[model samples]
Target: MEDLTPDLGDDRTLLLVDDDEPFLRRLARAMEKRGFDVETAETVAAGKAISTARPTAYAVIDLRLGDGNGLDVVETLRAKRPDSRIVVLTGYGAIATAVAAVKIGATDYLSKPADANDIMNALLAKGDALPPPPENPMSADRVRWEHIQRVYELCDRNVSETARRLNMHRRTLQRILAKRSPR
Candidate 1:
């Protein structure tokens, strides 16, 4: 993976924002090893401050921060540095959010547990390169679970509201939501 280091790549300053401290630290180290000067923030406010203080050449932001959506940081970065390449990484991935990220100025959208090499590839891809389809598509059960979780989050984790919006029984939604995420 070190071979992917951008010797001449425009990866000078990289802003990494995510609420997951462990993930953020690990990713920051990985990016630093890849020849990027990594700057990190655990909250949206900190991220916005960093971006405003010193513009970065590239950014890798989580979809949800401790305080707000990563889209907010994306917008701020785009406004401050229009040329900066920004990628939104999230554990909660959905078609709607992916579209919103792109429309909000994210160069790419990636699901979490992503490796440094994968993130680098996404950031550096030329127009000719397109993201490959999932190696193993989600099962129907997994898809349903993910959709339910997404709706649940959108409803602010209100079981009744989520059930109402999803047209599902409250108890059924509760049981499903209580279970762990599907592989």
Candidate 2:
């Protein structure tokens, strides 16, 4: 892969915000190898501080951080540096949140397990050009499981409430939640 340095001019700084420490470290290293000066934060407070103190030219933020939502950080970065490219990554991808992220100034919204290449492509994509389809798109089963999980979380982990909202039997919902996620 070619370095993105020249394409981005001198502003090669990148911010990576995620609650997953291992993922954050790995992504930071990958972005650095791709010619970015990377900085990482594991909480919303830290991410906000970095955005306010010294905004980067590009950012990849996890949607659900330990302290707060990543959209707040995206908004701050956008307000501080309007030209910055921001991508929101989430394990629980949903239409509503994706729209909200864009409205808050994110350049793109991607589902979790997205690779460094995907993130780089998102940041450097041309105006109004749609990102290419993911090489290994999530399976239908996986998508369904993710949706169920999202609803489960939204219902505050109340199994009965989630089942009711999804029009599913409580026992069935419990069984699904008990199983591991499909690929």
Candidate 3:
């Protein structure tokens, strides 16, 4: 057998896992510019598979993926590379998920729309200078609405199926979908 992996040193390597291809590509480029040799995966399976071979020295994982939640990926990275610094990013910012991500070994949790600077700062911070807290925390209703919208999108905008999957009445799902997104 041969070691097929590239010779990127741990200090210069980064693993970035996210479902959004555009975001993943953009971030990978930005991180590479910052001197890391970036490796990326868009699903939990892919992320886990990468983790199995050689643990990354740094990782930035999305909190939500098309296939599953990102915390599971974070856990795997933590197990594979206990010394790796991990950051979890999400579009759906929720207190519960942030806490969960941290507890699962993420060094930082950032909401989506985060620029490369924000991510880089979080990834590079040396256990000092706390990141600014969200000015407006997401309300429970807003979080619920976002989850419903995500599921609806995942179900290809099928109201009936989205409702069924959510175990909510179709009419209620329709009403929620019809309403404007909560702040």
Candidate 4:
């Protein structure tokens, strides 16, 4: 597919923020190959500092960072550069956080592991047009696992609290959490 590199402005600068070092490096390289001047950060603090110092025209930020929520960086970027196209990414995709990201000025929200193509498309998507559906959407079991994991993270990884909130037995929740996510 042809890249949709939108001419948002003269600034084709992109910021990529994620805690995953290898993923960050790979994405930065990919975006650079696509003609963007990419800057990267591994923590929310670093992301926020870079954003505040120099807000990029585009950004792909992970929802959770080692230091804090990526939403904080998003918020800062939006405040500094209102026209920026910012995409929020998360391995633990959750509706509440997606909505929150959008509410705070994210251009889009995508579940990780979103590819460079997907991230670029999201950043460049024009107007209100919806993105094409994923070729390989997650299975129901995987989705359930992600939801449980999200809730668990939100509850500070307290299995009992997560189970209570989910109205599931603690042991069952434990088993689910223990096992690898279903494909």
Candidate 5:
């Protein structure tokens, strides 16, 4: 495969993965202006495939994907392209999740509503410093479980309310929570 990392005239390439089309297009254009040859993927599967086929200098991944967690994509990239730097983004930002992404080999994490400049700065700083390892790995399932618990708590254990908040069915929520609880 051809080199996907842009030269920037300085020799670096950036890969961006997000399910948001508008955001991905805008960010790609912006990065192109800054001389980054940006390769984009709209799903975790696509991102993993692309990263596996290409040599990336850096990667920016969204935490939530259409098919899987963004952290999973980052993990695959980290394992496949160890020299590439990775930054994870999320709209549902949580310290625990961010730490988990880092623990899984992300170079940094950014909450949603991040600006282009912030993204650029992060990409530029990719190789300058390394983030400390996470205290513990956060399983994607565990994070989802925590989200379910928080929603249940907020809804006062009302399955209907929790389901409404989660955009799921009350029965589904009940089943998930039941599975999470001890027998």
Candidate 6:
């Protein structure tokens, strides 16, 4: 497929944050072809550093990160570069998270593996050049439930550990998971 990444040269800049290195490189290259000056970070810490150090026109952040939540990165970007549009992408797409993202000022939320067109559409929509995309093709609630299951597995079913890793309270995590589990 033709690269849709913008070529910014020295002017415009776009920040891409994701733990997936291969995906990051491919997306960055594609975005670069579309005319944006692309900068990539494999972790939330690196994303924060880039946001603090440079001016960015837009940011595409993954919802989960190795060191921290992608939402944290979105929050940082919103605070540091309010004008820079933010798009949150997650493999575990969830309505609750999507709502949270919008509440935190994300311009859009997407589910992975998102394509170049998805990113392009989000950017254009943020600039008021287009309308919001259709409702997520996948069920957000189901995705959230699956994510909770993963967390539970990782924590060995220890609610506290899962909550700690997710940056949520033990009670909250338990409550969410409880709701998802069958009767």
Give me the candidate number with maximum TM-score.
2
- Tens-place lDDT per residue, model 3, 49-127, is 8888867898999988889988888888899889888999998778998999998899998877677767777877777
Instruction: Write one digit per residue (lDDT tens) for candidate 4, span 109-178.
Output: 9998788878888888888987777777779998888889889988999999999999999999989988
Give me the runs in candidate 4 sitting further than 4 Å from their true place.
Answer: 1-9, 145-183
* Candidate 4: C-alpha RMSD after superposition: 3.4
- Give the alpha carbon lDDT tens digit for every residue of 31-113 in model 6: 87788778999998999888888848788999998998988888888888887788899887679999999899888888776
lDDT winner, 4 or 6: 4
Runs of candidate 1 exceeding 4 Å displacement: 7-11, 131-183
lDDT tens digits by residue: candidate 1, 1-183:
237476536548999999999999999999888889999999999999998899798999998887998899999999999988888999887899999999988889988667887788777676647655545666778778878887888899999999999999999998998899888
Give the Cα error of residue 149 in candidate 5, in Å. Answer: 20
Model 6 residue runs over 4 Å out of place are 1-11, 126-183
TM-score of every model versus the real structure: 0.73, 0.82, 0.70, 0.77, 0.66, 0.67
- What is the RMSD, in Å, between candidate 1 and the native fold over all Cα? 3.5
- Report, for every candidate in turn, its global Cα lDDT versus the true structure: 0.86, 0.91, 0.84, 0.90, 0.78, 0.81
TM-score pick, better of 1 and 3: 1
In terms of lDDT, model 5 sits at 0.78
The TM-score obtained by model 6 is 0.67
Q: How far is 46's C-alpha from truth in model 4 (Å)? A: 0.8
* Models sorted by lDDT, best on top: 2, 4, 1, 3, 6, 5
